[model samples]
Target: MFSKILVANRGEIAIRVFRACREMGIATVAVYSETDRDALHPKMADEAYNLGDGPAADNYLNIEKILQVAKESGAEAIHPGYGFLAENAPFARACDEAGVVFIGPPASAIDAMGSKTRARELMKEAGVPIVPGTTEAVDTVEDAMRIAKDEIGFPVAVKASGGGGGKGFRVALTEDELQGAFEGASREGEKFFSDPTVYLERYLPNPRHVEVQVLADKHGNVIHLGERDCSIQRRHQKVIEEAPAPEWVVDEETRERIGKIGVDAAKAVDYVGAGTIEGLFSSDTNEYFFLEMNTRVQVEHCVTEMVTGIDIVKQGIKAAAGEELDYQQEDVVLRGHAIECRINAENAARNFAPAPGKVGSYKEPTGPGVRVDSGLEAGGEVSPMYDPMVSKLIVWDADREQATKRMIRALDEYLIEGLTTLIPFHKTLLQTEEWAKGDTCKELLEDKEWLKSTAPAEAPKPVVEDEDEETAESKYLVEVSGKRFDVRVVGPALSAGVVAAPANGAAPAAGGGRKPKRGERKGGAAGGPDLVESPLQGNMWKVLVEQGQSVEEGQLICIIEAMKMENEITAPKAGVVEELHVKEGEPIQTGAPIAKIVAAAAE
Candidate 1:
């Protein structure tokens, strides 16, 4: 076994690899960028090295820097924990040249699978059921149009050869849309992957995104760890994944057959360590076609781990160390159903825009059969440089039905204040009848009405009483800097306050309080107190207000960059800016005072 391994990744995955290494009594070396100097993975590892600037190209993806870190740390092996340089063939070969073990499949396998078109050709030659599409790269729009007509026919997808995620992909329903899609896909491909080569594929309109997880050892022993149904997706990105694929849809016979196919594909590549064979399953014809093989651990690997009770990371490391298969194909057993929900820092209501900010209250769900693989803490800033996935929530149950219920309950308990999250969206998805019935496909993207219906109901409006008795009532005056604002409090304890004044000058009656209810006040005549405004949670990227400055509504007060993305903090209403409590680049917890915005009196 290796004494020390360098984890060439960041975020949750790096932490995950570190945990596995720790359990095996192997020391871990973490590499971080300038932005991630205070990242969780660096703190968790035994030794850490700087990978340069925050940009992926300058830091995580820089092969020379990663190799330097490995050499400096005296790491025997380098584990590319998915994303960044994980599937880069050159990185693997470089590790070999540097006399360091690469904890993944052979470089040859990565090269073959690195390009989608090449992988399709190899899979076809290996007698795997490949999707009907062009086996070669199409350089021009004319070539794409010709191939769409001659080979794939109508409704063809133009995809980047080296593209992953949902980028560099465009679907053309007709001939008129072919040229535009080709150009757009090519542009994105070149920008993202530095590869402009694009390919065409026959679009399977309503196919389920099903994939089989496989593990192999150096001795050519390969085994499939069952299938995961990832039909629930948005923008071609999987949102929810379930293991064993709901016995009714996959059945016992189909499972065995698919498992065998997965194993064969892995063996064909002489693959070692953990990988996944993703496929698109047509429910109408019950036909499955090979999509692409992910050459590294998948984001949804947790679901399979829950069902198999196996530590995949440990197995991956052991295999990379040239170990033999410890268990036979028959020895592998599937237990209860498992499901995983990728919790991202995005606003589901706003077209799923990335909502990167400070994590004010980062609370994860915990219970029987519930597990959370996260790299965030209470005050961790969600940076915008990396993937928006904050964490993964995986739950297990005896059956799919129970698993769904448990997942919903877990999501309810999962709280991430300060920024918007997809928790409500996940909760809505769990309650969907089609989801519960296992009726999902890629076509779910076209159903905007169905998607909108799953959103949570808006909060109820607060009711206000008459303003006459409000003047005589005791009012609390909270001073935020030099600005003073008047607010009516119902209870004796100021913490019991709830509703802020609505735009209509009506003081809404407070509902439930931390303590008993008190009387209400009218206006500034009632001697209202002033209060300071602060960011919900996140590092204080900048302080926009000074001691005394008149500010209007919708003014950009500060900018908080979390999870590698920037969030603009705006003024709630027209007020005079008073005291600025925070400075730039300072980490602030949830409810930390940011500035004081004193409300203007009625004219």
Candidate 2:
């Protein structure tokens, strides 16, 4: 076993790897950017190093800086935990060139699976089932149109060759959308992955996102640790995941077959360490097709760990150390069901808008069968500079029913006070009959009414009454000093001594005896036209409308990229763009006006 390994990641994943290394008696080194100076992972690791003072590109993704730190700290290996450089083949090769072990699959394996089109070709050659589509990159929209309309039919998916997490993926259901989807996918691919190439695949509108967790050693021993169902998603990003996908959908026969396919895929690349073979299981035909392969530990790997009783991260480290498989395929057993809910710092009410802020009062749930993998604390801050996932709330039980109910109970106890979270949304989702029946909540996620319904209901305000004697009064319940009490006041009106709970539960942090700070009033410049305010804080990726351009109601005005998700800002009413307050590539804040919209006929 290695004595020390550098964790080349941040947030919960880094902390997760730290814990695994500690359990195996291996000292861990954590690397952090300027924004993450006070992060939990750095504080938890044995030694820490600063990788300069810029965004991810200048810090986390700086291969040279990370390699320097690894050599300086004398770390025997470097573990790229999931995002950033986790699946980058060049990074893996660079680590090898630096004479440091990269705790993941071989660089060749990552290279083979790095490009979606190349992976499709390799899988096809290896006799692995894949979705029917072009095996080569589509260089132009004209070519994509012909491929989608003539060869693969309409409703095809335009995906980046080196993209995942829905970053460079778009669907074109008809010829009209082909060009835009192709261009968007390619642009995002270039922006996120430094690759402008994209490919075509037959889109499955109602398919289940299923994946098998694969573990292999350098000695050519490969085995699968069951599968995870990740169909419950929003914007093609997984929101929830479970292991041993409901028996109704994936039976023992299908599970074995899929598991074998995963093993075969890993052997084809001579893959090492932990990886995943993601597949799209048809909702109509019950057949599964190869989607793509993740060449590193996945965010949802904990669910599979809960069911299989395997330490996947440790196994990865051992594999990188040239160890042989310790367990055989027959020894592996699926014991129970596990579910993981990715709790992100976002508001589901407003299209899951990112809500990054200081965590004033962080209270995590704790009980049997419940585990929370988090890198946050009461006074920590969730920066808008990276992924919005606050933590992964994983629950396990003897059966799926118990696991679902336990998840509900656990979500209720979780108290993240400052920023808005998806706790209420998750609670509501688990309670739905469709969720209980193991049906992916795809339809519910699409329903705007249902999405808004996830927000907690506010208590009704007391009816105002006169101060006269025997006034018809309604009892008002309020919170005082962090305690709930029933105060029988003669009238609903506040007279002399009355206190209301602070917004976002921030009162307790304000000495628990004073009113919370007031927000600045929002009345913009006196002569300005109708202002188009930014809904959240993010980098303005694009400005769609030019000044003085006429636009209809709900017309696209701009796009803000935050938390790795794109949010489109649109015009509130029919108008002409008067003044553009901010330009493309500028950082904006919530409620800050980005443009001024005047009446269509106004001067």
Candidate 3:
């Protein structure tokens, strides 16, 4: 085993690798960018090195800098934990040239399966069931259009040659949309992968994403763990995954067959370490077609680990060390069922936008059969410089039904305040009949009703306002932690209040004047209470209540835009709108006052 290994990634995955290395008595060296100086992974590792600036181009993706850090730290191996450089064949070859082991598949294997176009060709040659498409990248829009019109036909997918995770992909259903789709796909491909190459494929309207996990060694021994059903997705990204795919959908016989094909695919490339063979399964015809092979540890590998009772990371390291396979085909066993829900810092109701912000209150659920792999804590800052995946919630049970129930219970226990989360969205999916029956496909999110009804309902409106009622008895007073504050009632009853210290250490009154006492207002006047302020930094996307408007308890005040998506900011309590501090186009930082609501005076 290597004395020390350098983790060339960030976020939860880096922390995950660090934990595995620690358990194996192998010291870990973490590399971080400027923005991640205070990241959780760096704090967890034994030693950490600053790579460069915050930007990926300058730091995490800088091959020379990463190699330099590994050499300087005397690391015997480098583990690229998915994303960034995990599947970069050139990076693997560089490690070979630098006399350092890359803790993944060999460079040759990576090259063989790295390019979707090339992988399809190789899989076809190896007798694997491949999707019908162009074997090579189409160089021009004209060629793509011609192929779509003549060969692959309409309703085809134009995908980037070097794309994964839904980037650089477009679907065109008609001739008019082909040229635009081709140009958009090419532009995204060039910008993201520096490759303007794309190819066409026959689009399967509704298909379930199933992947087989396989492990190989230098001695040509290859074995598959099991299959994971990742049919629940949004915007081409998987939101939920499960192992031992519901027995009804993929029975024992089909599992064995798929496992063999997965192992064969790995052997075809002389693969090493952990990898996944992704496929698209159509229930209409019960036909499966090869999609692509992920050449590194996947984001949802925990599901496989739960069912196989195998430590994939440990195996990855051992395989890279030239160890022979410890388990054969017969040795592998599928235990109970497992499921994983990716908890991202995004809002599901508002188009699943990224909602990055400081975590004011962070609580993770724990119990039997529940596992949380996280890299965040209370007071931790979720930066927009990286993926919005805050953590992964995994659950295991004796069967798929129990696992699904446990997952739903776990999500309810999980709480993350001050920023929006996809928790509600995940909760709805867990209870859906389709999900419970294992009838979901990749097009699960295409349902408009599911998207609209999943979110919590809007709050009720407050009572009507009286413009001429500016009497002392009409004012209301609120107390927070024994400090009395005064506020005016514009429309209805409000219970929430915000405190901001004055310049001279004196407390501000209802209207920014001298502080008032309980039951006392300005000049002994009476009015309603104040409104709650946003607890995080974001942009106000929607104004739920206007000036002098009434609002009820838990009413959605506005949709705050943070990270990349919108988060519905709700009213803390019932009240009438007294003041509006933020507009739709205005940007608000953390703890910035957004609005104030005045509640009715006490009887």
Using lDDT as the yardstick, the better of models 1 and 2 is: 2
Residue 462, candidate 3: C-alpha displacement in angstroms? 24
Q: Which candidate is the best by lDDT?
A: 2
Off by over 4 Å in 2: 458-529
Off by over 4 Å in 3: 441-444, 456-603
TM-score of 2: 0.88
- Pitting candidate 2 against candidate 3, the one with the higher TM-score is 2
Model 1 stretches astray by more than 4 angstroms = 441-603
- Per-residue lDDT for 1-603 in model 3, tens only? 799999999889999999999998999999998788767889999998887674688999999999999888999999999999999999999999999999999898898887889999899899999888899999998998888888989898999988888777888988898887788678668766788899999988778888999999888889899899998887678899999788877878788878888987898898999999999987667777889999999999999999888989889989998988678878889998999999887656656656676676789999999999998887676786677888999999999989989999999899776666778888888887788788774345776666766664442121222433333213456787998756433333223363444434654456533334434632312223464666556667668689888888888788775654335688878878778888886777655667787784676
Give lDDT per model, in order. 0.81, 0.88, 0.82
lDDT of 1: 0.81
Best by TM-score: 2
How much is 249 displaced in model 1, in angstroms? 1.4
Expressed as tens digits, the lDDT of each residue in 341-448 for candidate 2 is 999988887888888877777789999999999989877878889989899999999999999999999999998776778889999999899998888788999888
- lDDT measured at residue 557 in model 1 versus the true structure, 0 to 100: 85
Task: Report the lDDT tens digits of candidate 1 across residue range 385-458.
Answer: 67688899999999999999999999989977665667888888788777878988334445666556545465
Assess every candidate by TM-score. Answer: 0.76, 0.88, 0.77
RMSD of 1: 14.8
